[model samples]
Target chain A: MMRPTNTWFAEKLGDHGIYTQYMEDHHPAHMPCLEIRLLDWQQAAEIALRLEMRLVAVWATEGGCHDQPDSMFAYMGLAHPEHRHVLLRTQLGRERREIASISRHYIAACRMERHMQDMLGITVSDIPDGRRWIKHEHWPEDALPLRSEFAATTRMAQAEGSYPYVSSNSEAVCQIAVGPVHAGIIEPGHFRFLTVGEMILNMEERLGYVHKGIEKAMCGKTAAAGIRLAARISGDASVGHSWAFAHACEYAAGIRPPRRASYLRGILCERERMANHIGDIGAICNDAAFSFMHAQMQRLREDMARMHKQLFGHRLLMDTLIPGGVSIDLDQRGCRLLSEQTRMLAAEVEHLRTIYADHPSIQQRVIGSGIVSVNEARDIGLLGYVGRASGNYADERIEEAYPPYNELEVHVPQGRHGDVATRVWARFEEIADSARMIIRLLEQLPEGAVSNAWQAPEAGTSGFSAVESWRGEIACWLRFGDHGLIDRFFVRDPSVINWLGLELAVRDVPVPDFPLNNKSFNCSYSGNDL
Target chain B: MLKLLKQIIMTGDKSEPLPDSDAIELLGEQLHAHIRKHFAGSLAIRAVDAGSCNGCELEIHATGNCYYDLERFGCHFVASPRHADMLLVTGPVTRNMATAVKMTFAAMPQPAFVVAVGDCASGCGVFEPDHYAIAGAVNDIIPVHASIRGCPPEPADIIRGILQVIARRAA
Candidate 1:
């Protein structure tokens, strides 16, 4: 990256006569990799957006500012190329703990803002949807789980009544409600479909059924222990979340892991991305009644999962990431194994790609079904494969220029159709791309110590980090308490934003096609709910 | 089509060794003698996720795929609880899902069995006792016939647990 600069803040905000304070590399070495700045509280979103800066994540923490009655800190992470984030600090306080919502300006701020309000009891005024986002009736009225003062053993109130889902009143439109429990072996999410016969008019989803108080439970736990919680936030994307958490700790403690460790982490991340993508491509085909691809894809996934367990010590690669670097290291045999497997898998995937293109039955099922246009995808700020499929290059590896990535010539696969066919094609292309990257990583395995004994970060300091997961961007924002334990831990699983894509893609498709659409996006309920 | 046929011929015997005949025999005889006499040689299971990490859910799906082939064990996952002979629930019972868990349990016919799979459903796993969202453990919401404990139990472990429930009833 370029040497850190502070002039951009003044260049953008100077016209408003808004006071600006900037810090270079203010966060830890691997943190949300942003320079720090203080913006006028009211214009946080406006100032960042005016500079054409991309919004990464928005999070709030209960920390110092004791004199400002009922005050809590709200941080907005923004990205401006070659680097990743610029944390804009704003306070929500004065006894009310309320702030003007930025949801009207940035659509991504919608769910995250509602999450803050629901979990922290921070009232966000002018929020587009003021209704309970993360809170069901089970949360006791007085229990704001994320606050510093809340007890760990606070009892949940009895959940009561049904959710108030907004519905459109129209002539001859019927409603079909499905799940918190589904027919398939999957996590819980409720989908309400408004249909005129088989064609979908509108679809709305109600999630957070699996909110296990991940943020609340991690509080007071040491950073080492907190990594387990992060890994479990979304089991499928365990490596992504854990690395993000580890990077945040590394950042906060000012520890830069050795180059070898960074390369190993990159391998872990790409392996995760490939496994999910391969399985999803098969699953999307299965949803369209092409069962062979499903079986073959899953078969390939099972092999990958087996390899992960053999080398990394867990089926899902859960807990493979520790604070300073990876907990597991690969030897010569492991490197040879990865090399051979990548060769075999690439050939198999190439064979399937040809079959997918030539087989009319499969092509018919995938090509035109479940389309989410590019404009709609960008408006919500999609990331990773989903964003790439919609012609958006928001991959953090490229945009953030994180170590190892900057040194290597990384090729990001992109597509433009934004339909089931393109999504599947996008995932297939990603798998091939990842195979090439993994092969490269294995051949270039740097020689050094795999990890270091992690030093605890100072108390009262926090860090922000984002890693591109199989689905999209996984952001973790955290702080340490006085005893080197987690003070405030917040995770924004990419599924939290990508869930909206399901709503858009399912519209205009027949009722049966909804499953195909859902599978193509493959938003995880556990990830979003957490 | 020729490639598919050749591959099938080349990759022979994909199935695993069946469990001990004693367990299967006991399972068969037990159903023949006691609970639900008319139902013989087969079982219908409905999987419920009170609140879980979805790690367990993935393993459970693997059990049904060709490698593990759970259906060969005379068990099949059904869509609705009303038609199910047993319930396989995962995750710590979140408050939002507790009522639905109860409703699913109540809907099952008499002599229904509940198999609480994964450490989360059995003992609340890494999650603690009192958190606002989770109620902790599947047993807290419904009576459990068996508990399978793992961060995410292996598919083999899950299949064995389902059989153990029948063996227990037989004894």
Candidate 2:
């Protein structure tokens, strides 16, 4: 039984130098989540781990109070779902920029810790692999990217060092390296595979090949422009990432979007989810060599894209999402058209889904291939579809329901098999549910102006906003500076965590099934790299 | 099988068939005829993603669907650059991906027709080429023939641009 409340944990954390000092309760927006300060990072993390608090995101920010100028802040975004979002904060002294690694307790903290090390010059004291995670040779030897001192236009001498991928000299195993440039028209990412014949012994990924310095680039941009940058972080889930950014902007600004605006945002979010899921389902079938299913699903996807173009004026619905609210609005005719299209898609998908479900080839290709066991999924603490497929049953939509979703009944179907087949089936089930959401949203079209005006927040204050993206949970921690320009920005994409799941899933799988397993998860390279 | 045939007939090949007339001396038509005369209308294309947001890739893929059916016009996507006749590159070349893009271009056979698809490849999109992280666009990294400028050109525009690249190569 998974406990949802952290109230008991508060008692367990009793007087650990984490002050009971005043709290900011984000009650109406979310749960009565407390924002607390901690003095001992190591002790607090160990106690929280003992008390069973899931470590969600570890984001580090540079700079402090003007009097205490050399201070660095590290905030761990932890969640218990039913209770609240507990933002645990710890500060590091100026002289010793090193913090003890929490990656020992929680495996998800390694990437974020190394990210802090690479970008902000904050060292994680002792672990194992000390390879450069993000800052490549293109950056100068002593350049700290996220610090206020570093210039935005700093590019060092050309990249000088080659990545030292771990090697195995065993006679039985052989090494194979693929991409940063792949066959498909996809983003760049490197995969190093050690295989015994066709069976993959281990698969390690060296991503961040598409690192665009997105957070670094957001240094001086206004909140509106920062949303645009966020959208580009992951092209496939632009709406999800941008919406999370917008939510953070609104919260930090202390303004509420109207009911109509929230409803519009929900519609946009669900539509985005449906589009990506549909694409994934089609691509999965294609990888399984069932080209007919791919063709059918692709046709349905095209139909939906055309509908988006007609209604929202973009095939991919990239723009039209801004800081305050949606930039575009829909009328009655658009609603009627969307409703009819959803019915058509629902019926068509149902017919095609049966063909896929009963089909022998798809079943043969996917069943028991690239399985992540319940224990592994639990220990790794995967989120979204990857977690649900393994029976982890953490749906942020149900857990942290924001606005219109809080009103509607979001059906989160759980999966058990934890194989490629289970993942594909999960997408189909989720798509069907999203179709109903679309119809409901269109039918109950709330009336009011879509966009709202919001004022900027006071300087030096930060806000954390979370949204359940199609892939999984996406969160953004944002701080406002002078003239409402972005001060410090950090985002935790679902893909960043799920990419680890793929590495673990592919251990015993054959070389050929890699494509299928990869598509089953369909993690975004751009999203993870950023 | 019978139902499938009937469905195909009902769909009735929605593609608007373009004329293969030699009398029409437009650049694309001439290239189409010239390719037909030389390589029997076969054009193998290799697409390079130099850090695009993937909006262009989606439209590029839609061309493979039944509506456009780029394969019908003898335009096929090949896996390796060595086998490709033209390179359709997208996005502003990022500092990390710059080497991969250059290697991909270098691996292509000589007389390769490179079409800088989308405005990003020409260094003028939301992703600027002059940024510290971005090295430059496709042209700044490698030689290009035709610059097809659209944030993400529609499928029709991509098809037309490929034809224009073939014409440029034939010239």
Candidate 3:
């Protein structure tokens, strides 16, 4: 029997220089959860594996008495089906601050540990692979990114030279470097593809080409400013990012949004999901050279965007969701109009899907184009439609059942094939499901204030909140300072887990299919870059 | 040939429809009003990413989504500055992207509106000071007309920013 609270084995492990306790604070939105404090990093790793906690995020915070500047805090999130969350906190000092690498146990920790290493200058002992992740070798080795004392205005006097990419020795393996600047108008990322002829033998992606110093800029910002930062983490997922940040702040502050506001939030989130799905379906078809489906999907996507504009007065619904509640509301006439549009759109989608299913060319191109087995998906901990397509149905909407999602009986559409076609089908299914959910939510739309006045929490309390964005689970953790401002905030986007699947899915597929495979996963590069 | 002709007739003529002369005059007036209100008469704009850290790029990409219909306004993101009316960039302008940023700006045609979308772009947002690669804010590289500040600004803010630039040019 798996009870929610009994999921973690941390209770049985007991006091090995680590303080394990559940934090139930009402002030911040994410307060009512479990927190474990470890005196050292090795202890954090032991408990993480022993307790079977997934490494959600690893972020460092500069600590010490206001005068002494060398203390650091490394935070990690661990979870099980039984307990909603288990937070692991470790404290480190300048003299003896090395932690054992947990990347061996949890593969997800690889990038996070590297990020912490680059930012905080923390040493991870006995790591199998220790190549620089975010930090290029061109920069001074002594320069730590997340240090509080690091000067902001100082510019590097000399232009650093190019980074040396690692070479491969496998037979017929030649490296193909693509993008920091691509042919198309897109964000920058460096992809080193190791290929023999057309087939990709292995692929190594070097990102951070767009690394904006987001974490550093976050310091000294007010809660409102932080929400703006959160929303910007990934522009397409603004509602999700803002909701997650606000959810954390609200948890720390112990504020609940008005019921109507929560319902409206659901509506906005569904719209975001629908818009992305429609665009992606089109893009995927375009990648497959199916021009007809591509054009139709684009038209459908445009229609949805128009509906969004008519309702929210913004096409992407940016900044519509605030900390206490939503910034916009739907009137009776607007609600009626939205309901009608949704019905029409739903019918159009069904008709288009029929065309897609009956088209042999589309089916042949997509059916098993980029097959990621269920086992591989589970092992990699894939998220959203990509994960759902491979039978890993972990939707935060259904699992956590927060706010409006709790009101509507949400059914997550899942598939077993785990291929491009299956992923597309799953996405379509979710789109329809979201439309239905939106209709239900609108019909029973609550009437109340859309927002509540918010105040920062008093010092030394913390909280965590996880929401299912269109992509997957987005978890936010927050700690309040004495002055009622946010002391520490950490967010983990679904892309962090989903990107790993890309490396696996692209293996052995010809370079031509890379676009198709990438589109099927459609993980946000910006979301993960954080 | 006969079957094709019949099919075309049934589909109500496949060729481009010719405008009626009387209605054309009225339609032209409406078109002018719409263009004046929306397009801002061939204004040039440049995009600068102060230090996005790329979340904004996804939403920026969303601007091209059929639903958002950014092209309907005659606004398009151009690759080269020699032909570009605007420079749309994302991220915090890392040490690496700085030179590219400057080069991009230099390449763009003058009288351009520079729009900074995302928090990192506007104020370096979260990726500031301590980031190893960042040079500074987008303002450090180029003057900005409007700043859509989100971690990544929603596609709506982006569209709004474009409209604001056009509106200012028209004014």
Candidate 4:
């Protein structure tokens, strides 16, 4: 019998004919993994559902023989009820490039499964939506870029194929196609809405317009150098993506930086959260034709961004977090500046919140538009403010408790209704919470070194991290190779899950209100497409 | 209404002088003169995001914010390429968005200026110089009149780049 574990993994998975193994090298030291046979792929999903675990991410990497073109492995990341994350793995050979669909069990797995199918040619059998994802007819059908055998520099001529967007057959319903290029200064994605008059009958989003092949670019690069690529994965979530990437790498190498580094990382992440929340609140109001809040809130956000430039050297806090620690240190002057800024921002945000609440015109436009129910939110595996607004109070900071969040009293303010107004309110409350946390972090910051010399982990060592970025919980998986080069890197941005939430939220909403709902959600197109 | 008015008055204006104020003042005067001479001082721009991480887009959006107030320089972002006098493209044009970018440029009127906005648009920033997913820089995909060189250029740099493009057209 395998060693009995303290986690619910042993108790729930013991009878499922699958054995649980602790990832001795996996960072943060809390992830428990189960290696299952390829035949038991769907069975793992069944057990996960029975245990009330949410499917987080799915991807494929080269398996067994690195030189073999036909060998690959599929991995599933699941967040458990016990506050621990679990990874399920299954290796496949040339004979079996297919597995049963887990989307039947977890709706969140739909796009990820299609992504794996498109990127690695791993067929996901029984996947409800078999349409091509992440490849807008850019590459030929035979090209699978994630496989080790495929050269990264091999340029392919753009191929032509039409996306079969789901259409309506009724005369009463008319179809409207939106983008590959939109009117606003935003990222690209196509939205197809089947509507009757102004009421949306159904909505479908076709993304991948911004696929830069980040995973393909990171191949054969050193893990330390990959941070730059990670930061670019989602420009707005730079700190979140890079910090999660660095955390995974450090844990895989089993190198912990000084305690001061953890506190500083917390400060950077909270600042990122606050800045985005403030910006999104303003943008949502702007979408509703209320420009006053947009003007006021943007002024505050710009001030904070300028302060970030003064302290960390990047207006958006990009390139600030690296493996084993942070790139910049906070001095006494920096601390004082941060404290003053946070205090002032807290007061100003409260004033704006009052203005937003008191304005009846703004409330009229926002209140009842684009409401997502709690059940729908849970079904879609929504994270971050999107889920929080819908009553799914699952915050990785408080639940998974990654340090220094483990020490701080992290407040995740939640909303009851998942409408545009509630989502905006959640952002307002989160800004307040983030400001409070930043002030606390400064007061209790430890005195020590900010960065440590990065020691490369041995080849074949893999690490994982789930960080609660401002948008949501961003999950990163990293495997190191010879001389600290990254063998395979996978990052699952929260936008992947939250985009589905957007589709579900806008079901009955009017056509014009789509922008308001979208801005409230503020899902990242580049992040999701990557 | 009273509270809203009170808040607005108390907040006051946070707009600052554009970057390189002296040069911008001259360029602004020239840009307005050129616009008036040509299109009655109405300069419309359309921003296309080919495949950026959105760092550049954020700065571009910031340009429209009250602080930068890009419209004061006689250029405002428009909805369609047909209405545009200039095309401001961000990101290293990706393979997927190439056709769309070309279509947008083709749709614009004659003598449309293209300003490639960041290092990525001018040249692929972090990716390998010639990666598979990338279809070269903005210039390789479309005709670029001026390029702003920064990882993601600040709002001031973006305002300056736009003014210089129009100012050059005027000269």
Candidate 5:
């Protein structure tokens, strides 16, 4: 694979008349970061859009201290060609702490830009939707949680005013507001639907009901302690988020975990993927009122979770991946047990797939319901199963190939139709694929220590890492300050993009089918709210 | 249809016996008696996520699966608080969700019991108390009769916690 080198950035960016000053590649991972003038930020976005690069993440940082003047820096992480990532950085003067919106180029940056506005008090000018993303009037208008001086312990009184949801003036249209407290045993999110009788005209989602100030909580914590918070960012994606955070810290410190640990991390990640996929496959069916498939799938999922607990001491695989490497190892007995279980799962999943395909009732509910066109999917830059089901293939495992994945064979499934049925099929294929990967990992288990000693990186060192979690790519960036404490941390979960996919897919569908469509996407509330 | 029937027959009755059934029954002669008397031999629960990481919700969902089969004990999850005899709440109760949690608790009928699940709901867990976004644990927002303590309590532990709440009400 030909990676985009630092010099390559200078040559390519210079052609667009955009001046670039390349920063030293201090981080172990070879991610090329370029510093550009704030005026050229929109130009950079245009170039990235022309190159068909996805805007991976956007964040703002307050880089000031007692000695230096207060300044704000905005960063945009873009997906580059050949499994590489390029970060564009520009410093903003404190007097005019504002940046132009890049959502004009990347639709996926809409919510992320709004989120930076809410958390850091940075103004994103000229965005289509200027509504607050994560803020809900719970704090003072001036209080920005991510600002350097905003105390974490400051509690505030709640203020009142409904979110300015986009509404239509048609008298025939009826509006239905749901959630923040749903009927199901699920996370909290508000969804507003404008409908006439049964068909949905428009669907708007207002999330962040599960926001617990995770980024604000992560500041000043040690790298080891940060992993615990990262793991809990979204419970089901613990392995992916924690591993990404740990990888970032390790990259900054210039330490590579042992081969055995990397192998174990890979196996654990696949197991997490298999668990979530199995649960979701059943859930989608359940939402379609197929109780038989739901019950059976839940049974299979529960059994797999039990196996995980027997092997790694946690059903959800939380706190398993730490800063240096994995915290748990499997002996020969565990390996044999896992292999046997994998065989059972593969056969059972194949049988279930046949039943799901043959059932006419399930087909009627999912075949053409809640479709996201390929163009909309590409525009939103969806990832993981949702992206693959919609003809957008962006799996970090195959593209980035970090650690054990580079040594393994990855088969990423692709689908042309972006409907509920295709999403379910994508999950089934991914489960089988993950099972195969897990078995391969166990067979070729390496011999070495599972973890290495952690060393503190020098102050001001920053690092970034991206991992293909079950849902999608989880990208993490962090910097170390004095005394080895974390100066700043920002993470982007794939749900931020896929949630837009859900909103797009639900248009013109019956309101009754919203559950099925939502289950098919299964975007994480906490992951996005953070 | 034939394959479906065959598949069902082959799977058989997978609802396993409740974990620690003997001990629960011994203490829950009160619980069974309470359900039989007050709830007419059925317990209706409405689960609320105050502001959890959703780890606790997964365990609660598992209790509804085939192996746990929580309905066998005359306990079932209800979609509305108005129909609930108990409220199963989770998490540190963030500022954004605190009002919803209160409204949910207020909607339930009289003699309703609340079981705070997970260490986060019980006492803020790994999160800092009274942080800018967090309003504190479940108890700080509303009165909690029973609390289960764990990063995320297992399904079996959730059952035990729910039973403990009911048994106390029975007594």
Candidate 6:
């Protein structure tokens, strides 16, 4: 049955040279959704705007063997209801490589285009706000990082000095520069805040100081090894990162993980979600100067981490999901232990929610501060808690149910206020839902082999996978080499989408509340730097 | 005052069990002995990232997290040449990141053990090597210790790889 919405999109976009590939009727377990590919960048922007497709992510692909020499290819994943992903591909040659900026159409494309411009040197002409998004002035303009010809030796010989960070000059506005090295142990990134009497007019984030050359190093590894690297992208988001990687690899290989392995993957994924939510809620409260809540929530997070260690033998549950299946299996004892943990966590979270609700200081700090309205949330393409706070309700696990998600019942908590309080509440609600999903999944756990013996796929095929990471939707694209190694890989972390929202949401708010607002969002800096 | 009372009643005291000082010490000693036995002489490692977009840095950092502690194993991320044992790198090494990558390797002490973690580090898992920035695999940079693979390897895998390096050195 062709949904009316998709039919409307097909008609409108088809006239404008956009190709729509329908996969809605097909089983989602085999193929998640239908894919549409646009021939050029202009058509991509036009289709995205006209169709109102949420700009899920934008990534660049530098041609290896298949790409025409002196040319680059870029793809944009635009999503809509009915779980459809429209892929827009544009080709740019060495010299004449300018494409229209989609930022004017979809605000989320601004940072992504800047990222492409920094990495690939492709210019997004008419970008309303293109002031060097990722690249600082430290590197020469000609030195694009993602270019194939760019050698690794040049960085060492290059002189080391501070990159000229552009600052906004307004009377009474002073700049506060924090980090690369903070007072505490946090990831490396620079935050430049333009403030006038504790009122932040504009805040700029300079990340990638910890850029460890992850992409360049991935050139010749095997499939199995590559999955391990994906799991490490964010320690806390291991399952989400690996699931995205494994999904892409499996799609490329045309293999499905056993039902049991998929169920186990769901269990691990929810465990990750629960752990992060517990930690985040506490941290947000702590930021509001509520020490007691922080201590209690930290304790809950620790307990969940212990459960993860007991069940999966690794606290973070990394490397649990391989391409075809899982590395570990939950026996009967493990299943029982997980259920007990889930019940305990659910009870604790409920109690904590009541305590949090009654706290006036937390209420005052969070209720109306850092607001991102529903329209703004949609416009910026926010996801996870940021989107849920504003009532977007787009969780990939629920919207496009994959594996055990299809079987388990998920209760999505939505808020209309779109403030710090709403985000915190949404997280708490997700924790409850995640725990319930785990128990239900464990009950119907399939009986089968945990993982299949690894095998390599034939070269030159590409695939896409999306997983609901703790932050939001994480999408991955993978292509393999002739020698059975990964040829190209792109990971789109939720931080990429949420960071802009952070900038816009925090505007006009007092600077003292910055820490609380920032902690409430808690988007990972390391996740976005790559 | 009322809110405080409610919170106290709502969240019953649930404290995490502290790691037994004795157990941690014993584990530390055993780990040290294992490293000594496996890496009889000196051990040097080089870190390689095949391609990670950077999520793996967290667990890589977690090896140093106050919990699941890595220092007890004598494993550390060294900065410069002449004083390094292992290469603890991440990512697929985009065309842009490649240079700093080689320089870091050149600065490392000899007989280095290269441990590639995460999908991007192992193979260009998610990143296509053909991209304008990414060049090739970790092996393109240096020889490896053990491929403790994942999108990002768990801290345990990292710990396991260091132990393997020790074992290889003993052999």
Candidate number of the best lDDT: 5
For model 4, how does the per-residue alpha-carbon lDDT over A240-335 read when each residue is reduced to its tens digit? 999889888887887776789989999999999998988888898898888998998888888888999999999998998888899899999999
lDDT of 1 by residue, B59-155 (tens): 8887876666777666888999998989999999987788788988999998899999998999888888577677878988899989998878877
DockQ of 4: 0.81
Model 1: lDDT of residue B101: 89
Candidate 2: segments with Cα more than 4 A from true spot: A1-12, A15-17, A20-39, A64-67, B1-12, B16-31, B38-40
lDDT for each residue of candidate 2 in A192-253, tens digit (9 for 90 to 100) = 99999999999998877777778888877888888878877787788889888888888777
Candidate 6 residue spans exceeding 4 A from truth: A1-11, A17-40, A64-70, A151-156, A159-166, B1-20, B23-171
lDDT of 5 by residue, A241-341 (tens): 99999989998887788889999999989988988898888888898888899888889989988998999999999999888888999999999999999
Q: State how far residue A227 of model 1 sits from its true place (Å).
A: 0.5
Off by over 4 Å in 4: A1-7, A21-28, A64-70
Give the lowest summed-lDDT range of ten residues in model 4 chain A.
A1-10
Pairs that collide, model 4: none
Report the lDDT tens digits of candidate 3 across residue range A59-127: 666752321356777767665544445566556656866767777677777777887787678887776
Q: Write the per-residue lDDT of candidate 6 for residues A1-530, one digit (tens) a residue.
A: 11223355555666887665554222222233334442345665666666767888777877655546666777777777564654546566567667677777788888788878877788788887776655655556777766767753345224344555657766788888865433222444567788888788887777665454455445467779888777766767889998988888876676788889999999999889998888778778877898677766666666676677777777678778898999998889999988998999899889878878887877888999999999999888889988999978788887667788887777778788999989998998899888888899989998988777666676656667778999999988777777889877778889988988888878888888888888888887656865
Please provide the root mean square deviation of candidate 3 (C-alpha atoms, Å). Answer: 6.1
lDDT of 6 at A390: 91
lDDT of 6 at B67: 50
Candidate 2 lDDT over residue span B70-128, tens digit each: 77667799988999888888877777788888999999988788888887777647765
Q: Report the number of backbone clashes for model 5.
A: 0
Task: Give the whole-model CA lDDT for all candidates, comma-separated.
Answer: 0.78, 0.77, 0.69, 0.86, 0.87, 0.70
Better of 2 and 5 by DockQ: 5
Query: How big is the positional error of residue A109 in model 2, measured in Å on the Cα after superposition?
Result: 1.3
For candidate 5, list the clashing residue pairs, or say none: none
